[model samples]
Target chain A: MSSFEVPEVSNKQVIFKNYVVGKVNDSDLEIRTSQLRLELPEDGTNDVLVKNLYLSPDPYMRSRMKEDYTSYVPPFTPGKPIDGYGVSKVVLSKNPAFKEGDYVTSFTRWEEYSVIPGGNGLKVIDTSESVPLSYYVGCLGMPGFTAYVGLYEILKPKQGETIYVSAASGAVGQLVGQLAKLAGLYVVGSAGSQQKIDLLKEKLGYDVAFNYKQETDYNAALKKYCPKGIDMYFENVGGKMLEAVLDNMNKFGRIAVCGLISQYEKENSDGIHNLSRLISARITMRGFLQADHANLQPEFLQKMLGYLKEKKFVYIEDIDEGLESAVGAFVKLLSGGNVGKQILKVATD
Target chain B: MSSFEVPEVSNKQVIFKNYVVGKVNDSDLEIRTSQLRLELPEDGTNDVLVKNLYLSPDPYMRSRMKEDYTSYVPPFTPGKPIDGYGVSKVVLSKNPAFKEGDYVTSFTRWEEYSVIPGGNGLKVIDTSESVPLSYYVGCLGMPGFTAYVGLYEILKPKQGETIYVSAASGAVGQLVGQLAKLAGLYVVGSAGSQQKIDLLKEKLGYDVAFNYKQETDYNAALKKYCPKGIDMYFENVGGKMLEAVLDNMNKFGRIAVCGLISQYEKENSDGIHNLSRLISARITMRGFLQADHANLQPEFLQKMLGYLKEKKFVYIEDIDEGLESAVGAFVKLLSGGNVGKQILKVATD
Candidate 1:
């Protein structure tokens, strides 16, 4: 039917312009409209054409913007679509594993529609649950899994232990504090703004939430808030914040480093002083990636759904409308301008 | 018999004059002669007297020289006899656990004779073997145990992995390099002096050894020596050397921070930069104390003794004769002037 009269299926995409040095600017990414062929290739390639619903612009994406950044993911190619974790609905499928109308989460591009080559990175989502679709990119997706693995595996939180989460209002930190509290830990958090700090205490049920901006001295603030000292630290922000955590960490304390969002922008960062405290205090500091613990995904999804259904967990997401807001949403995320998990709502089912 | 004529039982001791600021100087300790009454208490105190043999002036002891250093052991009490790990001969005993003439390794004062109340920390050495008695303090005691725990427990060496030990010719590093080789690892090390470097390569059998003092850039040095990035690091000297190791650390690397000898004398240590690499590389850096792994001691002692007897392991010690050389030996040890395990030979049994 489409061959006779082609539908006006012009796909709007956020394109990577070039690799960035320090902080990413508006010029680093560009919004461009490109023609779409809504049909799969007949060359034995199992590509699935999907209509993008939501795109999660996480802090980790900034790493891909660097030319030399090597990690689990390869660097995004300049002049092409930027891909990340997103929610999508299958429009057409050549892959037997996925079919039309199948709702799923996959590594998709920042575009109105994406022909996910060979249906790679796609995982079918169970739409039978009443959970919001965007939660796939927020709580039930990568960030949530990161929070879970970091807390349970690395930190190994014990009941009554004090767990301090930095960037407590951000995507991963929000869930970490909530999960720590469920595990019978005394949860403390630090966020950039008063609004974010209030959200941490009032909504997230953190025992103590402080505005790091208002408090000039991080060490003094930690000392005041974490009076008994921090038993475990969920580190997101790096530099001064991490140093302060080291200062307040108790003997045999553990640190789960999920991100260093603060240092990503700086070419030259101030090195951590008092790492010697790591020796005197007998601390175990580990850097972790969620991909390493993919085996735990099935249990993670099930348990997180149970928490959501029982009204024990509330996940907050800041959604910017359409593919046009993709760059702005990511920029806001890196600059600490957004509240909760930042997402770009490309379309609605 | 003493009623007719008194014996010249003068206890010549090294007394701590005061706590040190910056590097410890000659004035910080004093050698004094005090008379001793060579009799055990009859009031059921369970005291044991020991004649000191070899005293280990380990790098960790420098921390105790500071007035405010808090750790597994308390700071050395100024003006009181400096207590340390030593090889000794039990002179008199009311305690049934240790009798007179028992050769043991224990926490003994730096003196000709020390009254160890209740014989606490007295671990009797099995002197049936032909190994040197001074070996008790050097390889078969605390230093050797530190090496064992750091290598097998902390680094968790895999066969064919590269392990780079800083302060390679020192007490702990010497044993660490040897143990790593036994574990089927490629071992590299760094020392301060050319003599120490030669000792590491020629005597200790390290695959590669470099004099860190001659290398201006530690990162470059590690790159040259450790062509394959280091998988495990036995961290002894902290600061710039540690920073360089971080740059050369392979993904999923483990750093066992045993000591920071370079930082012990500094009032303000240059903080560690490039810690963000920990996150990017997913590295695990841990600080450990040997005492915490005391359960592994029996196995360590037996295995090490076996290695020594088999001639598969060679332990070298630099002995400074008499209690008079105690302060000088300690200075040399901390300054990296002494090669191998630095020991003060008191009244050798």
Candidate 2:
């Protein structure tokens, strides 16, 4: 170890070359290791040097490139390192709460090293665990928070209500289904393939699961599975699916609009006509960002960990071993190619 | 009055012929005035016969006929008169709280007379001197309640927020826009015609107004009006309008799903595809029924009456003379022909 030059301390990052129209290809991103040092400058006031370990590749990235997406949090800069949720270790810190060797979870570029700023964006990850650290990038992290907030805060799951989640095998959807089930809800979910559908019912314990791709009529499928009608819909893949759900939702039904992977790829989308269902059924649909639910991390982690220990919750991860593979994995995840949380292992244990 | 052999009348009704579609024709209803020759019934028995004077023509009635609308409320039975919120004079009381001659509001049929049984659905209307008796069927009635519930209860209006209400000069929309303006919001509205648009800005006091039919592209119109992005969308028209609104919604914006008149007549409707915006924008979209907000009526009426008396609020009504004209006027109302509350003057004042 002493004989090594530390590779000149350069940084490796995944960058989006340009915005693609339809399905994103692997060639869209380039993994270039910079000649710049990975460590933060000694005089940098608020920045902290982070050694990235795990990175989450969510489906929402697909919608970021569209010219229509201007009003949202600015899209990933075309030539800059693509940023997302990740787990990292602080190698150096100028921020008061974070010190050298501290672990934190936040939005970080898909790179082996990064310099993050101080203030409200960063939080120290408490590790008194009987769990794997990578779980922080999946179940104990953003995806988990997505599920927790959707169920407790948005959906407001009541006992015995019929809950339906789309993309049931995805990281957030899987956790949401399980949480609804724990609350004594009759849960149903839809995934792209039969394999994913089976995973939802068999592994995730969803009361009913359907392959939405194979189901020619999404509304008919919803009617078949949700005989009494849906009390809540945890939306993931929007478009025809939402139209169908709107038609089938019961009175006072609550919908947590989480993700809509289906329409993100399309340049022009179709009009939504079933909105009258909102008036008739009196549904409450809300969209949320996980960052807003940071205050609930303690409660979410405590409950999720308890479920993990009792074997009540199961999480599956699709791993990409290198930064170069992150783009392909992310693209595939957007197209519903991955079974669960699409993860990139930037630095292995 | 002496020429007519007014037998000891018991009850009279206007029964519907059948479920009419498209535009309601005159043949749809028949007024059957009869005398049962029975004395006034007892109280606490749920039976109350009120001589109904005013009946509201709401757009939601169009949805009540569809076989698919069972998810909300049961369809109006064909033989029974179509019922909605009405201001009536209680001639005989069977419900304990409501006495004879009391002006009560209930889901009364479109008839000269109605017998309502107290199964938890009647409210005594204490007429406010500041407003007209007809207002109970308009501003101080269901429309006001709908606006109050949708804006304050569902939308949670914040100061200076931009709110866009469709059907701007219509019953619910007019009140909602005015209330939003009163709440310090920058309110815009979309109406059916230039006249309606004029009424929105000049009469209803909407900050900006557009005639949706004249705008070839809803999305473009939304962009033009809400350049900085809309903080809240009071959704009424669905189909293309909803799709367009989705594109212009700001992150964390709230959309109160009030109604969807655009798609009610279409056989095969367009599906909502832009719902994916919910994920990227972290928007909160919810729907509510006025029936659920019944509890707020007392307070709503109090405030609304004060506004009307003080001239802070002005409501317009498109009245059709006699029961004979009701069906046509209601049909016109459904076609977006009427500018405001479409009321049927069942009896002479």
Q: Best candidate, TM-score-wise?
A: 1
lDDT of the candidates, in the order given: 0.90, 0.80
In model 2, how many backbone clashes occur?
A: 6
Where does candidate 2 clash, by residue pair? A272-B272, B9-B35, B10-B35, B10-B36, B46-B117, B46-B118
Compared with the true structure, model 2 gives a TM-score of: 0.86
**Candidate 2 CA-lDDT value:** 0.80
* Segments of candidate 1 deviating more than 4 angstroms: A1-8, B1-8
Please compute DockQ, using alpha carbons, for every candidate against the native two-chain complex: 0.75, 0.57
**Model 2, range A1-349, lDDT digits (tens) per residue?**
2324334466788888887787677788888988655444456477887888888887767666654565346777788888888888887687778888877886787888887865236677777775777788789887888899889998888899999998899989989988888899999998889889888988898999999878969989999999999999998877778889988988888888887777777766655666767776777788777777779988988998899989998888888887777877887888788988888888863
- TM-score for candidate 1: 0.96
Candidate 1 C-alpha lDDT tens digits along A1-349? 5575645589999999999899899889999998887777778799999999999999888989988887778889999989999999999999999999999998999999999999999999888997899999989999999999999999998899999999998889999999999999999999999989989999997999999889979999999999999999999988999989998999999999899888889878778878888889999999999999999999999999999999888888898998888888889899999999998899988
